[model samples]
Target: MCSNVIRRMNEQQLIDGCKRNDRLAQKELYDKYSRKMMGVCMRYVNDRETARDILQEGFVKLFTNVDSYLQEGPFEAWMRKVFVNSALEYLRKMDILKEAVSLDQAPEASSSFHSVLTELSAQELLTMVQELPAGFRTVFNLFAIEGYSHKEIGEMLGITESTSRSQYTRARQLLQKRIGKIL
Candidate 1:
C-alpha cells in the first residue's frame, strides 16, 4: 500500500505513482485536475452533463497513457492537451464541426471590442462563450484560448484554414454583439 498522503504528493510524485499504477496517485491526480479539465471540456461543450462525460473520458485516457508522458514539459500542460484532444474527439464524433463555413476575408476584432471584453467579469465572458454555437465555440477555443494557429486548428478539426478563420471570426462577431447588449 502507498504510504504517502495523496494530498501531500507533489506533481512529479503523483506522476511517478500514477505511472506505477498506484490507485491513490490516480485518485489524487483526478482530484487535483478534474475541475480544471472539466472547465476545458465545458468550453467545448455547452452542457454540464456532456462536459462531465468528456472529463471522465479524458481522465481515462490520461491514466491509460501516463507511461507515455516524457516529463519534458509541465505536466499540467500535457494533461490539458489530453483533455482538449478528448473534447475535440467527442465533438468530431458528433459531427458538430460540419456547420463551420469558409470565408475568404475574415474580419479581425476591433481594438475597442477588445477593450469591451476587458470590462466583463470572467463568469460573464465564460457564459458568452458558452452561448456560442458549437462550431464557433470549438474554433474560438482552439484559435484564441488554446493558442493554436488556424492551420493547426484546421488540421485538428479536419477543416480547411479558411473555415477555421471564418468560424473564429464569426464567434468574435457574435461575442461582440452579445457584449454590446450589456454596455
Candidate 2:
C-alpha cells in the first residue's frame, strides 16, 4: 500500500513534468509506456515496424495535447485513448479498414468456439489476433478486447453498426477455427 502511494506520486510528478515540456520527463514517460502502447498498436497493425511507427506518432500526439488533460481520470487511460485513436487513424489512412462484410466465409462452428482459447497464453492470443484480417482484427480488438460497443466502434472506424457487428462475428469465427487447429 505504501508503494502504491509512492508510485502515484511518481506518476503525478511525471505528468506535471510532461505538461511543462520537460525533456527528461518526456523521455521517462516514453520509456515507461512505449512497450505496452506498442502492444496496443500491434493488435491493430500486423507488423512490429508499423506498430512502432504508430507508437511514435501516438506519443507525439500525447505530448502535444498534454495541456488539454484535466486530471478527470487516470493519466494512463488518457494515454491509451490517444494511442488507440492514433492506430485507428493510421489504419484509416492506409485504407485497410473495410466496412463491407464477406458473406462467402464459412458460418461460425459453435458456441464452444472460444473454449480452446483459454488454453493459450496471452502472448499466444495476441499472435492469433495479429493473424486476423485487418477489418476483422480491428473490430475484434475494439469490441471483444477493448470493450467498445458496436456503435462506438462503428463511429470510430467510419462504418455502420451492423458492419461492426458482422466483422466482430466473423473475427470470432475465424479465431475459433484457428484455435481448433492448434488444439
Candidate 3:
C-alpha cells in the first residue's frame, strides 16, 4: 500500500515502535508533540534558548524511558509529566528553584485577576508569567496552570507546603501588578 493509504497508528503503537528503536516512529512522535511540549518547557523557563534545551532534554528522556510507560493512563498526560519534570530538573540544576521567603500572604483570587487574564491573549499571559522571578514562576506554573496542589509542588521542589503557598501568592501579586501596568 502507498504511504498515504497506510493506517495511522495509535499511541501504544507509537510507544512500542519507539521502544523497538524505530526512527520513523520516534520522528513521528516528536513531530506530533514537539510544539505542545515546547510550550510546556517555555512556561517554566525564561528564554527561548533554555526552553529549547529543556525540550531536547525532555525528548531524550521520553525516548529513553519509553519502556516505563504503563499504558494505564493517558499517554499525553504521561508525556506532559515527563516534560514538566524535565523543566523542573533544569530549574533545580540551575539553582533557580530557590528557597522562597514565606510572604505569609494569600493570592487575591479575585475577579480582577480573572478579568485581566480574560483580556490578554494566551501569548501575552505567558509573557507576563515568564517575567516573574524564577521561584514565583515555578510555583505559579505548578499550582495555577498545572493544577498541582501546594503539597505536590512542595514535594517536587523540596519545600514545605506553606512555602509553595507563599510563592504562589507572591507570583499572583506580581502578575497582577504586571497586568495592571499592561492594562
Candidate 4:
C-alpha cells in the first residue's frame, strides 16, 4: 500500500516523524535501532530479558524527549546515550553499584592482561565482560566501551571517580583470569 511505502523513511525523516508522535515512524526507528540498543543494554545488564526491558524503556524515553535533541551530533549516537542512560537507571534502581569495592581493596593491574585481551574475539570478550559482577560490568561498559571517563561515570552512577577506576581495574583482571583459562 502507498501508506507502507510512505513509512519507509530515512533517519532524519524518522526523527521528524517521531517528534510528531507518528506511530509508523516510531516503529521504523525501533526496527532500525533495537538490535544495537539491545546490545548496549546487554553490556550493562547481561540478562536478555532485562535488556529487552531496558531497550523498550529507552525507546519510550527517547520518544518522550526527542524534542530536546539538539541535532548537534549523529542521531544514532544520541540514541545510544539514551539507551545507556536507561540501563544505568535500571542499575541504580537495583542498587547494584553499591557492590563496588573501594580502591584500597582492588588488586594491582596486570600488564600481561592487555596482551591476552588482544587474542579474544569480540564475542569472547563480551562473554567475559558479561560474567563480571554488576558493579564491575557497569563501570567497564561505561569507561571502556562507551568511552566515558571515570569522573563522568562516577557522576552518572553516583560513585566516586576512584571507585569507578577500581571497579574497571577489577573487571579487567577478572576478564584476564577468565581468558587465561580459555587459552
Best model number under TM-score: 3
Q: What is the C-alpha RMSD of each candidate to the true structure, in Å?
A: 3.6, 3.0, 2.8, 2.9
Give stretches of model 3 more than 4 Å off: 1-4, 99-111
Alpha-carbon lDDT, every model: 0.86, 0.86, 0.88, 0.85
**lDDT (Cα, tens digit) per residue for candidate 1, span 20-126:** 99999999889888888988998988889999999999999999999999989999999999999999899889988676434533344544666777778877888
Q: Estimate each model's TM-score.
A: 0.88, 0.90, 0.90, 0.88
Q: List the residue pairs that clash in candidate 4.
A: none
Q: Which residue segments of model 1 deviate by more than 4 Å?
A: 1-6, 100-111
Expressed as tens digits, the lDDT of each residue in 1-183 for candidate 3 is 576455387667888999999998999899889999999999998899999999999999999999999988999999999999999999989997884535454335544767667878989889989988889999999998899999999999999999898788889887887787776
48-128: candidate 2 lDDT, tens digit per residue: 999999999999999989988899998888898899999999988998787444667645666674557667899888989
In terms of lDDT, model 4 sits at 0.85
Better of 2 and 4 by TM-score: 2
Winner on TM-score between 3 and 4 is 3
TM-score of structure candidate 1: 0.88
State how far residue 76 of model 3 sits from its true place (Å): 0.6
Worst 10 residues of 2 by lDDT: 99-108
| Residue 172 error, candidate 3, Å | 0.5
